[model samples]
Every structure is written in C-alpha cells, then in structure tokens.
Target: MDTAPARDSAPPRTTAADARRGAPASRRPVLPYLLIAPTVLALAVVLGYPLAGLLLLSFQDMTRRELFSGAAPPWAGADNYRTVLTDGFFWEVLARTLLFTLVCVGVTMALAVPVALLMRRVDPWLRAVMAGVLVAVWAMPVMVAASVFRWLSDADDGVLNWLLGLLPGVDLDKHNWFYDPWQGFAVIAGVVVWGALPFAVLTLEAALTQVPRELAEAAVLDGANARQLFRHVTLPVIRPALVLVTALLAIGCTGVFNEIWLLRGGRPESDYYLLGVYSFIESFAVNRYSTGAAISVITVLLLLGGAVVYVRRLRALGEIE
Candidate 1:
C-alpha cells in the first residue's frame, strides 16, 4: 500500500541533568574537577614537591658537606628523629613554644574581641577611624614593625625605657629587656599580639555586622542583659570567626621567629628559641640539614593535627557543610 510506513519510535533524548541522574553514583560533575585541576597542579608543582623533598631529606643524614658538594646524603632512617626526640633541650624548646603560643593567642583574642565589640557600639565615623587605624597597622611591614619594637625596647636609649624612666621611683633606663628570658618573651608576645590584633579585630567586626538586629533586640526584650545577650546571641553568631582567628593566631605564634631573631640581632639565645628558630638554628647555624628537616616535619605534623581538629570543630558546629 502507498501509505507511509509507520515510523519507528525514537528513544527519548536526555538532558544533562537527566544524564547526571542516570550516571553511576561514583560519577561526579567533571566541570568542578576540571576547573580546580590547574590549581591542584600548581600546588603540586610548588608546595607539594618541596614538602615531599623535605620529608625525604628528613630521613637522610644531610649536612653542609652534602649540601655544598651536591652529594647524596646517607640514609639515616629514624636516627635524626631519635636524636631530636631524645634531646632534653628540644623538649624545653617545645614547652616554651607552646607556652608562648598560648599567651599570644590568649592576649590577642582578649584585646581584639573587646575592640571589635566597641566598634559595633561606636558612631559610624568613629568606627571608620578605628578601622582605618587597624588597616594601617595591618599594612605595616613585619620587618618595620619588628625594627620599631626592637628600637623601643633597646637596652640603651630605648623610647620604652625613656618612658618608664619618667615614672617616679622607676629606673628602667638602659634596662636590658633581653637579659631576662621571661621579660624578653613578654616583649616578643607584645609584638605578636600587636601584629595579630588588626586581623582578629577586623574579622570579628565583620562577623559582628552579620549579627541580626532583630535577634539582639529580641534578646533585650526578653530581659537579657548585655552579657547575657552576648553569651546567647552575639557570641553564637561570631563564634565561627572567633574560632578561625584563634586557630590562626595559635599557629602563627607557634612559628614565631622573625621578631626574636631581629630583636636579638640574628643570634637568638637558647632562651629565645621557638620551633621555627630551633629549626633554623639546626639547619643553618648547626649545619644539620637532616635534623632541621625532621624538626620542620614534626612542626608540620603538629599543625596538620591542629587543622584537623579545627575542621572537626567547624563541622560539629555546623559552620562547615
């Protein structure tokens, strides 16, 4: 018959979404991975290789000889680690580093939180001024700040000593702040906190801006005092930022070296050794590259552990998805 043959039924076409749904569960969107591929590759080339090399170097008995001669260092296995771990001095330095970190982080948070809260309550112009000042401080070079601090706490003719000398019965002129490790660390901690404050304060302030006015007013309507309002409402809103800043501060403090190094004229005494300083001294000063690499590896492990804990905390708080 001349009638057209019945056309065969064609398969339904699928859209991208449909294809995604029909795909195996293990298959994810490749676009995201593709977009990130360049970044991952760059990091692998820059940071990953160095980190891997450092790890490998830690297991070798590298020294000045191998470094200058470009010779392969002897395989040391765990000998370098054992030597560092067995040293009482290393333990002392670790303890000092931890203690210094605690103090710096604690003081920074204490000062920053209050300043941030103050900013929230102040006039907009005042807040702007404060923010400008903080930005300026943050923008200042670390080297310049450290130099200024060193000059201030100089053993002779220091502005700090001069100011203290102004106080009746206080004779701090020509005082050697570095003579006492405790006092020296106090100055170092001060420098750290000063440098850290701007970031913490600005971060907290930004977080504060996100606090719902409705919630704050609601709390006030519920007869909540300022402290209670903060405890129940404000703190919850800012808690994520607070935790982040505190974690960063802790990590930064643990790795402090520049301030001490500059203040002590590049030859910091045993009393002034933090983990970073200790690593540098072992590697460069003592010419024990393997030992330094081991120390650095340990420090990295500790930092990684802290970061894991921080991530878990964020997840627990529902701050991270």
Candidate 2:
C-alpha cells in the first residue's frame, strides 16, 4: 500500500482588516502624526515660547533698565496681578472693553447677515461685483484706512465736514471728531465695522451656499413663509459660521489697538483706554513691563474662559462632538 506523505497545513492568510482587528486598540497609525510633527513643533517653538516667556515676565519686576541692560529682573511674585486687580481704573477698562466688543460683534452680525442674504438673491454678475469690492476693501492696509479716516474727520478742510456743511442747518465745518470720546468711539466703531464687513459677509455667503437647495424648496412647498423658512432651515445651516464670525469679531474688538492708537495720535487719553491700549501704555509709556505682561495674561485668561464657555454650550446643544 502506497501512503501519501501528510501535507503540512498552511498558515491562515491574514487581511489588513484582520490584522487591524488583532492589533492592540491603543495602536494608531504613526504616519499622519509624523507628517504633522514638524508643523506642531514649529508652532510650539514660535508661539509657546513667547507665551511662556510672558508668563515668567509677569511674575517678575521687569523695568526698562532690565530691558536695555539685558539683566535679570527681580522676582515680584503676584505683585503685578495685585496692582492691576486692585486698581478701579483697570475694572473700568475691562468693562469698557467688554461693552465695546459686544456692540461691535452685534452690529457686524446684524449688517453681515442681511448683506450675505442679499448676495444670495442678487444676480450673479452683481454678486461678483459686490464680492470684488469687498475684497478690495479688505485688502486695504489698516494704517492707510486709518489715515484716510483721520483726514476725513480733520479739524481743518475735511471732506466729511464739507459734506455735512451742505445739510439744512448742520454746520460741521472744522469739527474735531476726537475731542469728544463718544464721537471718537463712534468713528472708530464705524471704521472697525467697515473693515470687518468683507470677511463677515464673505464667510456667511459661503455658508449660505452650502445650504441644501432641496430642503429650502421643500420648506417653501410646505407653506413656510420667507421668515419661517429662514428661521427653521437657513438659520440652522449657517449657525455654526455665524457663531465663529461673532467670536472672532469679539476677540478682535477686545484687542483693538491700532485704530485707537492712530486715531488718538499715539497718545490715547484715559477715556480711550482699552485693555490693549492700557497694556501698551503700561509697558512702553510708563516703563512697567511686568504690569503690562500681567494685563496681557489676564486678557488671555478671559478670552480662554469665553472660548471654553462657547465650546461647552455648543457641545451641550449637540452641535459638536
């Protein structure tokens, strides 16, 4: 009898999915993380170091002497923080900053929503023209825009005064816009809103374009009026974008510096002191680097707290994972 040799059983072949399932749950793909490592490292070096330095500086008593002489400053622990928190003026500035930011964000959103909706309804050519104009305005340098606005509101020979002089009995010739803090802030707010509109309008319009046409048409067919359709459908679709724009505007307005500094001729009065301007005045004008750093830290903490609150709210609403 011929007996065939026993054939050795071949090992079972494993597919990628099978191997993945067999792998430890903690094991993740390394290539994606490796690819992003350089960027993360660069940002840490660029941003993290400065932030760390600021924190350290806030704890010390750094003066102009230490700055120019390259000598280590004396440690002051929490003195800077104590000084700022105890000052009534600091509270006023903080309150002013918050109120101003709220107003700017409110006005920007109010104007942006309508403009974006109008762009959606307008002819394509008109939309393109409007977009181009907005882009041009957005591209304008802040300094140049501020200078032009200054000239327009100049005490002598201003186009705005000239135009206002034409009104029935409103003589605004030789008007000093910066003399009154309220009027000065209004002008600054106008400039801020004008510069901000392009980005807000464009972002909202882009979000609007992502809205499902079928859903809108279905809502219209279901007897939903224009207001109802927007409230029920359009608003939900663009809510995320609106929130993002509003947050950014609030942060920007809170840190407003360039416009106020330029408009006030680089010497903002007590009435015009926002947080950023106050910090600048403390650091450079008064040579209190430690106090400035402390203020900067406080501003950062406030912003971070706001961000955390917004994130939690969104998560609670099931808007984010």
Candidate 3:
C-alpha cells in the first residue's frame, strides 16, 4: 500500500506527453474557405455582376440612345411592369409560356422516367450504348439542333414531309408547321422535349443505380413485382434526383429562346414569344433596353424560385429518410 501511494505520487509523464501531442492536432489551423474561393469568385463575376446590372437597368426607362450615348436614363418605377401586366398580348404570351412549359415538362418526365427504369434493367454493355446515344444528343449544339430541325420543317424539300409522303394515304401539303401558332408551338414543344429528355434520363438513371440492391432484393423476396418495387421502394430512394432533374429541366425550358427563334424562322412577331424571345427582340430589334432588362430580371427570379422550391423539397425528403 505504501509503495502504491509512492508510485501514484510520481508525475504522470506519459499523460503530459499525450496531452502535448494532442494540443497541436486539436488546434490545427483550418483553411477550408480557400478551396471554395475560386467557385465564389467565378459566381461573383459571371452571375452576380450581370444580375445586379440587369436589375438596376430594369428600373430605368433607358432607350438605346440613353444606353449607348452615356446619358442618364429617367426612372420608370413600375411602369415597365405595368405595361407587361396591362397589355392583353402580354397576358396571352404569358399564358402560352406557362402552357408550353407545363406540357413539355409533363411529357418529358413521363417519357424519361420509364425509359430510365428500362435502361437500369438492361445489360451493362447495352446500357453503355444507350448512354452514349443520350450523350450524343446532349452534346449536340443548341444552335445546331435548331438549324437541323429548321431544315427538316422547311416547306420545300423538308425531310419531315419527305418521310410523311411514304406513309399510306398521308396528306403532305396541307400544313405549314411554322405558320399557325398552335402548329408552331407543337413543333417547339417537341423539339424542346427531345433536347431535355437526355439530361432527364441521365440524371434519373444515375439515381436508379444508387438504390440499394438489398432493398430491391427484399422487395422481390416479398412477392413484389417490378412495378410494385418501383412504386414503393425505388421511387422513394430516387425522389431527390427526380426533384433536382425537374428543377434543371424547368430552368432550361423556361429560357427556351434558340429553338423558338429558329422555328419561327427568326420572325420577331411570332406568337411563340415568351419572356426569353421578348427580351431578345426588345434588346436587339426594338431597342427597348429597359423592357429587355425587366424581362431578364423576371426570368432570373422565376428560375431562382423554382430552384428554391426544388431544394426545399429535396431537404424535406432527406429529413424523412
């Protein structure tokens, strides 16, 4: 007992050394912000500066002369916004935009989900080939897609008409696809959906692959069929991906200018005019710089709202998990 007390009286050398060793490790200087600096700087230059300038211009009644001649433009208050709201044609254009976005998004998601599911079940080699095709579609230049489709939809010697001619009892000469508003809209929506589907498929397919195999196996063992498994298990697991892809698709669809511009044969007065087309026409054609700026600001706000809703949904889904 006496010896034990003597040993306890000795200084705890190893403990002191251990505490000394841990002090440096625990007080390690953190510089995580350095890694994210480049991303923050890029966003500031690319998105932030332009966005700020656009918002400021939206409130000014700036003509082309005022913009280019360095003269200060008078304030417009809500005048530009009022013009957009009060004009019957503006309301009509807005309605068309909403309808087109909803229809195209609905169709794209409807087609893409089933296709993604099928691709998941396919052999790896075949899946790779399918992904390659989608990548090719995605990699096509937006302008190039529009140009090719324009050539196909031409009234003379167009491939679409050429193919229609081969169908039994098909009337080839009745419709000018780009002439009527509804016809033009159909073509536009179709082209937009095709362009957007590749991204949707790619995103959802990756999500499908992330689904745990054991969950699927358990479902199968419990007499769950393919449809049941997807409905109950797979969908819940991939809901976040679906939300993200939907947001991306919506953002892309909301700013559909190039395809509509080309499909309208670059007509300024085409009924397919949305905010995107309106902004371009205002800036370059009509020289309504303030109006163009306002439209751009609105489009950006709409996209941001959609993105926020998407992220919130994703967060809520994650919490339930």
Highest TM-score against the true fold, candidate: 1
Off-target runs (Cα >4 Å) in candidate 2 are 1-32, 317-319
- All candidates in order of TM-score, best leading: 1, 2, 3
lDDT by residue for model 1 over 1-321, one digit each (tens)?
A: 599999999998878557545667577578978999999999999989999999999999987788889999999999999999999999999999999999899999999999999999999999999999999999987888888889889978789999989999999967999999999998888888889999999999999999999999998998999999999999999999988998898888888988899878899999899999999999999889999999999999998888998898887777765
Better TM-score candidate (1, 3): 1
lDDT value for model 3: 0.83
What is the per-residue lDDT of model 3 for residues 47-73, given as tens digits with 9 covering 90 to 100?
899899888888899986786799989
The residue ranges of model 1 lying beyond 4 angstroms of the native Cα positions read 1-28
Clashing pairs in 1: none
lDDT of 2: 0.90
Per-candidate Cα lDDT values, in order, are 0.92, 0.90, 0.83
Q: List the pairs of residues colliding in candidate 3.
A: none
- Comparing 1 with 2 on TM-score, the higher-scoring candidate is 1
Clash number by candidate, in order: 0, 0, 0
Per-model TM-score on C-alpha atoms:
0.89, 0.88, 0.85
RMSD of each: 6.4, 6.2, 6.8
